[model samples]
Target: MQELSNRTSAFTDSVIRRMTRISDQYGAVNLSQGFPDFDPPKEILTRLAEVSMEGPHQYATTWGAQNFREALAHKQEHFSGMKINPNTEIVVTCGSTEAMMAAMMAITNPGDKVIIFSPFYENYGADTILSGAEPIYVPLIPPEFNFDANVLEAAFKQGAKALILCNPSNPCGKVFTRKELQIIADLAIKYDAYVITDEVYEHIVYEPYEHIYMATLPGMRERTITCSSLSKTYSITGWRLGYVIALERIIDRVKKVHDFLTVGAAAPLMEAAAVGLDFGDNYYKELQNHYTHMRNLFLKGLDDIGLKYITPQGAYYVMVDVSEFRCKNDIEFCEWLAKEVKVGAVPGSTFFKENVNHLIRLHFAKRDETLQLALDNLSEIHIKAKKR
Candidate 1:
């Protein structure tokens, strides 16, 4: 029998979404995926209702809704300390997923090398493959999840055309310090390669550990492609709103790619979200405070449980050290954990190219009650693996 595309033979299904399914199978508390289990902002809902009644229900402008672009420019400039042109620097996309794909399509050619930090957000690997680019995996070594500057430079020396930077990173939750970002900027500048940054967690940072826009770094604005989303921020992951920002030249190319890929983000959703894009500073302050509370609650729980883990500086995830359990592999441990403990986690191997499996990632983007339930479930952990 003939098979499906061999291009995809190396890929398995998303472990994160698979965990969601497993949770369904067992009624487990799923901390595997990083999405909020709550309603989106009330204003966004209100605007969505109004948009549902009114009909621009058709396709928005191919690049984006004009209002959305304008709002995004304003918001980005305010945070980044760099003015962005609404007309030439932004493309609204389905999510950071599409924004990033558009970015890869815009800048990369087949066989180009793109550097990805290890234990990265999983989508990045698939993005590189499907975009026809080869990935150079650079180890952001564990515990503190810091990368050695010389090793990172080595990846660039190997003819990498771009690097995917995930600030306030997802699985490991390390916010690149300003000094660290400067070092990266210097490298990208020296290499003359593009910097594609995934900054969806821009506002989900903890106090005293702020997220720096890579594009805002000296000599980086024109060369950086920033992919960001409203998914995490507004608790509207399903709404699938995101955008790409670059210098006019890169945006010109990405807009063409995005046009063919998604033909613009959803029309009515984009229109409704323009209102959210303009939400006041208080909205962001409240967002940070809410995520801060969740971070504290979960990290404190891990501390009390005596779990060895990297304390996240930002983002909604924590990468825990599970070496004490004497696991054969992370996948087996995670499966045993789900069925036996009734709480799901993502095996750290899925995010790494190396043989390291001493880690597991969890999300705290749940309601307090839900958080408490998972914590309670984890409190009395006992796992003698059923299969291993």
Candidate 2:
């Protein structure tokens, strides 16, 4: 065969999804992928059932259905303290995955440099490559997952055209505080760069740690492209309902890119998820409580077993330290964990640009019984794989 495109050649299959398959193969309790094992909100499900028969089954507008976008605008404004125009400022996408990709395509030219934090969600790396942009990785130093402002400013000084911000960050579970976000906002303004955000866990944040929207920061609304989804918030990952919110000028470009990418998000799914977008603050409060309960249950189990892991302030994931196990390669260790320990986890290396391999990422987004099973399996790790 002729040579394939180099754009995709460097990409491996998603480590998260692969671990899910490994979990299935081994009958391990799957915590590697971050979807809930439970059903979505009953209100969303009920609306979906109604929409099934009422029928708008065909594609909606290239951007989104009018009602869905309006609901999204209302929801975002309610939380972010920024008013948004539903017509000109939003582009509904297949999911935040597409939202991020479309945002990259809209803003980036080949050979441009985009700043990405190390230990990021893996897709950000691929998105840069696919967009033909070179990535400048600024390490978010581990343990506390804080960045040195000087290091970050250096990346901006190097002519970075954009930066990807994942608040309530994945894999590491670091939620950027408002002060930290303000610093980033200042840097972005000083450098004349865009901030493309992945705020998928916006509503799933724990207490004492809040999700602050970059668009709401001073001098940032025009330069911030907010990519978020109903998947994580509504527990409807299969629905693939997500959107990009930016100033009208940026959103116009995103709409064109999004239109060519997927035509539009699913119509019936958008209608159903609008109900979720319209949900009151009480619903979000209850969501935080539920996730808090799950986090406590799973991490308490790890604590009881005498395992070491980072306690996340916001997101549902926890990074367990495996340095004591003496595993040279995190990938091999994760495979062994799946097969022998019967608990699947993502190798921490998959999410980092650095040579990090002493940690493994697991999520607690499952039901109580499911988490208990994974915890039971994990409790035997010392006996099964500990280096003598």
Candidate 3:
């Protein structure tokens, strides 16, 4: 047998998914993966059932279905304050995962450098590597999860071809603010670099912290590539309907990359999810309220349990500090948490490019009962999770 590709030889199974398996094995309340344990919106579900019977069950088009794209464009315009040409500016993908991968492939060449913030979503690192590009990591300082403008400009000064921005970031759950995004937009413009934004949690922002579209920032519309999905907004993670919105010039390349990658997103799923795209502002307001309730419910339980964590501003994930447990490693502590505490979490080290192991990431995107149960199980952590 020939040698395996070095591009992926060093890869380990995703710590998040691996923890989910461990949680299942131990019958622990799984919070390792960030999906809701509740049902999607009733309207979307009803549409899905109807689409199942009267089917566009086969492929729609290489880019996307006309109705789906038009609906997405209308919805995007309603929120983003920008005109979008559904035919030329959008490429529907299997998911934001594919949307991101296709966008990276379209824009990067071997040896190109992409600036990625530290403690990023695990996939971004792999995406840069698989695109044959190098990553320049700039740390988003903890506790507040803010980055220094000077350090960021230093990363840009390294001739970075692009920057990956994950707003309402995963693992840490820090929402990038408008001023912060403007700093990024300025640097990107100064360096003539592309800004690839992952805004999946665009509608799940809590009060006082707004979700600003990076593309909406001054001088960014042309160079920004927006990759988002219906998964988080509509609670349809399995539907895998996502898309990339960019200038027609960039989207042309992305369309080719996406077409060869997955052909197109599922036609029936797209049709069903298109209903969600047309949802009025009230739907988003309710979504924010629902996630806000979940966040408060879960964090309040943590407060009662005397656990210290970084309060999330936008996303549903919280980084729980476990340095008091005196564990040898975060990975071991997480495993023990699943087996003994009966709750699942991902080691904070899995998401960091630096040496950070005193934290663990847990999500609150579940039913109130499910979150309460996890909290009930976690209440014993102080004693049960004590290091040997």
Candidate 4:
């Protein structure tokens, strides 16, 4: 066989998904992946069943269905306090994964450099590579998961064409405060670079850590390309319904890229998720409460097991310290943990650009019973998975 595409020659399959497979092979409680084991909202499921038979199984507009975009625009406007033009500013993609890719392709040239915070969601690395952009990683130092403005500004000084901001960040689960966001907004303005935000956890924030839209910051409305989805918010990960919201000019290019990429999100799914987007404030309030309960339950279990972890301020993920174990690396530790301890987790090293190897990420998005089971398995980590 001929040599494969050089651009992807060095690519490895996703570590997160790989751990999930290992978990299944061992019949371990699979907390490696972030998807919830519970059901989506019943109302959306009911609508989906209706749509399956009613029609619109064919593709909707290349951008999105009319009702979907309208609903999304209204929801976004309600939260961000910015007027959104559904007709021109939104292009629903396969998921936030594709939305990020489309936004990168639309804004960047092959050699352009993009800034990404370390301990980022894994896909951001792939998105940069696939878009043929060079990545300048700035570390969000652990424990508190805070970044140094000087380091960030230095990346911008190197002529970064854009920065990928994953607020309510994955792996570390640090929600960017308003001050931190203002600093980023200021740098983006000064550097004249675009800000591509992945705010998928916008509605899952815990108390005292609110999610602030980057586009809501002064001078950011035109420069921020918001990529988010209904997957996390509405628990419809399989639906693959996500969108990019930006100025008409940016979205015009994204629409072209999205059209060539996946054409459009599934029409029936879009119709169903539109019902979710139109949900009232009460729905969001209850959503936050439920996530908070799950977070508390899982954290309490970790505490009882004598495990140390960072408390997530927004997202459903928690990073637990495993340095007390004598493992050679986190990857091996996670494997042993799954097989011997009967629980699964992603090696924290997989999410970092630095040489971080002493942490593993577990998610609390599962049902209460599932979390209990995982914790029960994890209680044995000190005994079974500890390397001698």
Candidate 5:
């Protein structure tokens, strides 16, 4: 038999999902994957129920249902102060995963180089490889997760076609400040590169930290492609509703790639989620407050146990330094954590291009009781390490 395509030979299964399975096998508190354990908003759930009974089960337009796109445009405009033409500038996708993939395929030639920050979400690596783009890694140095302008510009100087920006970045939870974004925007303009933004955690920011849209920066509206999802914001990960917002020309190409990829997002799900897109400012405020509570709760637990961790400015994740435990391999440490400590975590090495193995990421997007339980289990890490 002939062998399969060689492109995927280097690909390994997702470390996050693998940790989740290990967590299940050991009956550990599963915080390895970044999905909420709580229910979605009642309004969205009610609308979904109604849509299930009603019609529109057939595919909507390949781009998106008209109403869903319109509602999304309004919500985006309300937050970002940028006007979007729903019919021309939007492509609703299976999730932000597909949205990012579609945008990569739309913009990249086989040999194009893309810039990605180290300690990034693991999917970005796979996305670049699948799109046939070589990736240039720029380090977002730890402790504060700040990037050096020179390092970033050097990546662009090597002829990067685009840079993937994860505002409220995963693994570390560093929210880019306005001044930092301005620097990136200026470089993007100087280098003649596009910016593909992953803003799924846009509305989950904590106090004193804001999520500034990179597209809103000067000279960026045309070149920035924003990819986001209702998964994190609306607690609807299973719905698989997400989209790409960009200029008409970019969306035109992305639409074709997206169509050939998944055909269209689920019709009924899109129709129902339109209700969530129309939610007023109050809903967002409440969402932020809820996340803040969870963050404080989890962090306080870590503090009480004298564990060291970086406090997130936005997003639901916290990176705990595990160097004190004297572990050299984070993957094995995480496996032991799940089985012995009864808590799951993703090895930080999986998300970094650098040789990092002293940290592991834990998420707080769970019910209060669940968070408490995980915290209770995590407090025993020192004892577990001693036994090992």
Candidate 6:
């Protein structure tokens, strides 16, 4: 075969998914993929069981189930202070994965330029490529992942059509401050470009820090296309429920693309997830507490082992600098880590458009025992590992 499609050449298999396979192979404690190992809230499971027998078992409206969309609209309004018309501005898709794809298709054209912050979630690379848009990667400098306003403004000045903002970003796990979001909002408004946001970790922020929805910014509501999922918030990653909130005009276009991409999200899962969306404020606060404890516990373990890593402010991942330990190739190091150390991590190279590879990424979304097991294994990183 000469080639299957131009899109197929853009990326290899997702490194995060590959880490999961390696974790199983070596019987390693898996803290690579960002999914909660514990069971989702029991209410969702019971609701799902009820819905399966009850007959919305068939296809939902191509956009979304009515109840799910309505619930989502209310939840989003409560959090972001923006009123969304469920019928016009929302589309329920299989996951934020599909929502992102539909959004890219809705907004981008061939050869168009889309600016993305580097050290991005690996999916953003493939999404831009498959949508036939060229990505202009603006590097988010290390430790503290922040971008320069001038640098961002320059990307827009060069005819970029959209900027993909991943708040509470994956891999690096830095949440954008409200002031930072305002800067991006200013640039998008200045250039008349769209802002496609991935905010799946919206509710997972550490205390005192808050998740500011990009759409909530002045003039941003009409221009921002928000793609988020129930996967992170509800701990139901397998359920594959996500939605997009956009201006009605953009939603109309995204709905058309989404209708063909996934047809609709799974009906029963949608019905069950509605329970999660309408959950009380205390539920989210508790979720934050759980994650905060995990973050501190995991960091404590890392500290004891003398590992250097960024402290995550939001999301469940941290990217550790592996250069000091003399790891030349991250892929080889991660393989060694899995087979020998019995711990799995994703090579950070795959997440970058820049060519620096002195790091690897890990997630902290496991039971306390599992985190301890990984930490215990990682303690020996300095012992058996070769030093530069």
The lDDT per prediction is 0.89, 0.93, 0.93, 0.93, 0.95, 0.90
Q: What is the C-alpha RMSD of each candidate to the true structure, in Å?
A: 1.6, 1.0, 0.9, 0.9, 0.7, 1.3
TM-score of each: 0.96, 0.98, 0.99, 0.99, 0.99, 0.98
Lowest summed lDDT over 10 consecutive residues: which window, candidate 6? 1-10
Off by over 4 Å in 1: 1-4, 383-388
What TM-score does structure 4 among the candidates reach? 0.99
User: Local error of candidate 6 at 286, Å?
Assistant: 0.1
> Model 5: runs farther than 4 Å from truth?
none
lDDT of 1 by residue, 1-388 (tens): 9998766789989988988788767777999988889888888889889989995798889988888899999998998899899998888899999999999989999899999999888899999999899999998877778999999999999999999999989888888998899999999999999999999999989878889899888899988999999999888898899999999999999988988998878898988888888988999999999988988898898888778888888889888888888887888788878887788899998889889888999899999999999988888674333334
- Candidate 6's C-alpha runs over 4 A off are 386-388
TM-score of 5: 0.99
Compose the digit string of candidate 3's lDDT tens values, residues 1-388: 9999999987888889999999999999999999998899898899989998999888798999999999999999999999999999999999999999999999999999999998899999999999999999999999999999999999999999999999989878899988899999999999999999999998988989889899988899999999999999999998898899999999999999998888888999988888889989999999999999999999999999999999999878999998888766999889999999899999999999999989999999999889999999999988775545
Q: Answer with 3 or 6, whichever has the higher lDDT.
A: 3
Worst 10 residues of 1 by lDDT: 379-388
**How high is the lDDT of residue 100 in model 4?**
98
How much lDDT does candidate 6 score?
A: 0.90
Which run of 10 residues does model 2 get worst, by summed lDDT?
A: 379-388
lDDT of 4 by residue, 44-95 (tens): 9899899889978998999999999999999999999999999999999999
TM-score attained by model 6 = 0.98
Clash-forming residue pairs, model 5: none
lDDT of 6 at 8: 73
